[model samples]
Target: MAKDMLNAVKDRLWQWLSSDPGFILNHCERILFMNEYREIERQSSALEKMQLLLKIIIEKGDDSCQSFVDILRIHQAHYWQLQQFFKPNTQGSSSPTVVADGGSVVTAREMENIRAKSINMKIETVSGAGGSQCGNSTGQNPQADYIATGGSVICADKICNTSTDGDFNLSVTVKASTQVCPGLVDETLPSSQEPAVKMIRQHKEKLVDCLRSDCSFILQRAQVKELVTDRQYQNLKDISQSEQTVIDLIDRLMSNGQKSCTLFIEVLKEPEVLRTYPQLKDISWC
Candidate 1:
């Protein structure tokens, strides 16, 4: 049974391993013993090194296939991206999950899901009032080593925390839902109900003047984020004054047909842009 499993696994994995020799050899060097790796490294070509790496893992037996997988995941090997072909996670009871010997094992895939869920949450600032998930406010900030004024709030794995440094300390309690609890929302805060682009175009005149000094700054950022193209960036740069730069940017966005003006509006709210243009804080939508 084991021999058949080994041959099947080897034949299936070989094509993926052999597809990129340098990639396989690079990862193998980290997994294989240094002395043994040096001999493999001395092999004339990447194909030879990969072949030998597979041979070494095969000789070590079935458990080593899982070890090989664990290491590939460790180095973030490219094979994992071909999930359609490499479905290790769906192996059921045949493949074992390895737990590292030491402290907690950190995986990027888990962290990515956590961050993805948190990004859509909008943490609007209010009067520094108490926001406890349990609905009990002591009317005083909690005794803590540090405090946060405000920035972003993250809700993950039933815990919510503010990445803040200014306002009174808040302690949000547990809930399995991926949203910021409705209690934290301040209903009275000024916000627009209209689509962001429509709201932006409605206030274009005011925004242009407000954004004058920051045109070059906003342009560089907008281009970097791909909201504006290379040609637009260069053309805007050649224009003499900050006011014209702002004007041309709006005109291009209006003509581009992507309704990308909202993206420009979003760029104004970015943390880096806010440092230069804090007035943008006034632009918010529901």
Candidate 2:
């Protein structure tokens, strides 16, 4: 029964992570830009929830789930650092403000604060799992070792003895950052004025071909094949959609009378777009 409960929690977390397109896009943008502390905090909260679920799974889940837990651990480590980056610098100031360190500029006390907050928080567990639904154990914090050494906290044996009944609610509640459209140039450049048109044209075709190849490869995968039998049709549709998105972005940049190939490459590398079609990473736009 415990094993089944853990599996259900794992499945729900996986579904939440995979099904939210906007969340994934936002997450990618946060990782790429490293700005927006609010978004980082939102993501950090979600990661904390997942970390709790993972701990539960490790304690009672099947051996197969171990590999998935290991992968999640890597993500947890990454977000841990990000959480520290965005952690409020309240040690010296009366007003709470996020620490926007562009580089490695954190103090030792700040690091300790991050570690404490991560380990000391209480994560509400999935209810009706036939066990205690809180994370506190023996009225003693189970995070002393982790806090001292700055190591990963072990939550397997720490079970909270409280009762709460509800579905596992891990949704992040934060307003998304405002979206700004790229400025379009009023005057169009003549063919003679654009020196890299030929190069761009060739690069565009190469990108489209790569997108089609990636679509084909995705359709051929065993997991995808089981869900969709019309592989050829799906592959074509995916390829067309990816190609159009890339072409549209490039066209917008070029229409702005932008001459720099490097700028065009950077726009294409935006996290929102790149998260959807990672195959473009292989292209040498320069």
TM-score of each: 0.31, 0.20
Query: Which residue pairs show collisions in model 1?
Result: 148-164, 148-165, 148-166, 148-167, 149-165, 149-166, 149-167
What lDDT, from 0 to 1, does candidate 2 have?
0.36
Error of 2 at 251 (Å): 19
Error of 1 at 103 (Å): 68
Instruction: Summarize candidate 1's per-residue lDDT along 1-286 as a digit string, tens digits.
Output: 4434546666545555554444455445334664464456455444565667778877777666666666655644355323322334433343233221111121211222122222332223332333432222223233211112222123222224433333432344322333343454553221122255456667777768877976888889878877665755776787788986786666545433223656776777779888888777776644
User: Against the true structure, candidate 1 has what lDDT?
Assistant: 0.51
Flag regions of model 2 displaced more than 4 Å: 1-5, 11-61, 79-264, 267-286
Task: Give me the candidate number with maximum lDDT.
Answer: 1
Candidate 1 matches the true fold with a TM-score of: 0.31
Clashes by residue pair, model 2: 134-160
List, residue by residue over 91-160, the lDDT tens digit for candidate 2. 5553332221111111122112121112322323222122221221222222111121111122222224
- lDDT minimum window of 10 residues, candidate 2: 143-152
